[model samples]
Target: MKQKVAVLGAGSWGTALAKTLVENGHDVMIWGNHEKQIDEINEHHTNTHYLPDVKLPEALKGTLDLAACIADADAVLFVVPTKATREVAAKFAAVCQNKPVVIHASKGLEKDTHKRISVVLAEEIPADKRQDIVVLSGPSHAEEVAVRDVTTITAASENLASAEYVQSLFSNEYFRIYTNQDVIGVETGAALKNIIALGAGALHGLGFGDNAKAAIMTRGLAEISRLGVAMGADPLTFIGLSGVGDLIVTCTSVHSRNWRAGDLLGKGHKLDGILENMGMIVEGVSTTRAAYELAQEMGIEMPITQAIYDVLYNDVDVDDAIRAIMLRDYKSEQEFTFN
Candidate 1:
């Protein structure tokens, strides 16, 4: 079914998704704050700043007017950064009238509240203005997806129908979508994996070998699964696309902002300097702090997250943090046996 989809970000992911929707025969409009970028997208059909060298579909449009972009849209997809989510959602709620199946592709927990993006959306958007929230997440990178590379992701929602609805909108020859009912697991895995990606990049920058990288990734999954299960997520979801799949790609890919940020940090660069140089939002940097706080508050043992948090927040050296992690009391490799 053809639908008018409003994409609430002009970043690489937003433009890529908007392009996909347009190609899929849906009416898509991307809302961006920058007039220059919006004009570029509308007039030139390109978003060079984010997805350089990639040409967007001419059918896809961009608008500076948020209200105009979302007006009469069948669905609203929020792809903005975590910090900007609430502000954008509130604005959408104020202007939106009809109920749209709200979808978010952004991954990260709220800084202080430690809430998932879906939870943040639910809080800011009034029930009368929106339907069930769906989270689209996996190993898909904007650069790859923009080029029509084969990619698969999970569209997760507690409302199964909504998840399937989202899956229909995004599934195509190059982009495939799977529906999952475990919104909590999907969202948490999506957010927490960025933290591990940071550690992975740090390991790389610190001159560690493949063995160290493998250890961080494997142990990182354990930490993610532990906290995720404690927070009421399904244990099996950890092995699915949003968990291991997302973790592997984010940790290993050069396209990951979190990994790049962590690489700089591992090289002994200051957080502020690294962020300023990156010219993009590194979700892991903020996620490390949130996860650290959440783990401490919940009494969950997430040592890797704590180590990354210390390096980012407490001015602890990356080497010292790594050493501390390695020197921690050893225990059974498997915390619990699977039947």
Candidate 2:
């Protein structure tokens, strides 16, 4: 059964998602901010700006006009970067013809609001008209998904029915989906894992090898779980796909923008140098501030997250940051909260 779907953002992840929908036999319309990207996907079946080699399907059409693209769609996939989510969602809501199920694919806390993505959606689009809201997240990278790599993610909504509905939208041989109702745990896990990913990337930047990365990843979860559990998340959710699963992949995977940003910084490049080269929003960059503030407010101790914060915001030298992390007073792993 074909359903009309609108995908916002023509970035790598958005393009990959649009491809999945088109291949699933949906009437997919993509909205790109750039005229060239819109032209590429609409007329040429490709987005040269992001995924260069992957050929998009003809079933996927692109447009720069947001209202025109989403007017008749049954659902809209918000795939824009976290920084742009609010502005785009506001414009999207203004011209929305009918409230369709909104599926947001971005991960990061709003710097200004400290609000979760779902909260932002609920605020921008009235709940009654918003239909259903769901978020899909996991270790899946856009490049790998574009190449048809085996990827699994979790679909989370306030209600299980909505989660299951979104689950059916992306399930295929190459892409697997799981449904969960813990939206806070799922979204928190998604956002905080990026900070840990930065720690892992810093270790990699220092040439620490797999053993160091594995250790960092394990301990990193301790911090992620501590803050999340304190804030009302299911502890078990952190052990699932949205938590450890996403953390391991993003930290170790070469395709992760956040990890790459940390890597560039570890190699002794300044923040400006890194941001200039990447040319994409590294969400962890902004979320680091939010996490630091959250941890302070909640009275939670997150050494790894703090170190990344220092390195990114305070201009702490990456080498000194690593040394500081290594020198933290030894205590039993579970002494603070895990046990």
The whole-model lDDT of each prediction reads 0.92, 0.87
- Ten contiguous residues minimizing lDDT sum, candidate 1: 330-339
- Candidates in order, TM-scores: namely 0.98, 0.97
Model 2 C-alpha lDDT per residue in residues 1-339, reported as the tens digit of each score: 678899998899999999998888888989987887788777888886678889999888999899988987888999988878888889988888687999998899989667888888888887755787899998889988998899999999878888887888888899999999888889999998888887777777777898888888888888888888887889999999999999989998888988888877777778888888897888898999998988888789988889889988898988898789889889886564443
What TM-score number comes out for model 2? 0.97
Show where candidate 1 strays beyond 4 Å.
336-339
Compare the candidates by lDDT and give the number of the best one: 1
Cα error, residue 253 of model 1, in Å, equals 1.1
**Residue 136 C-alpha lDDT in model 1:** 95
Can you write out model 1's per-residue Cα lDDT over 1-339, one digit (the tens) per residue?
A: 999999999999999999999989999999999999999998998999999999888889899999999999899999999999999999999999799999999999998999999999999999999999999999989999999999999999998999999999988999999999998999999999999999999998888989998999999999999999999999999999999999999999899989888888888888899999888899998999999999999989998999999888888999999999989887888773120
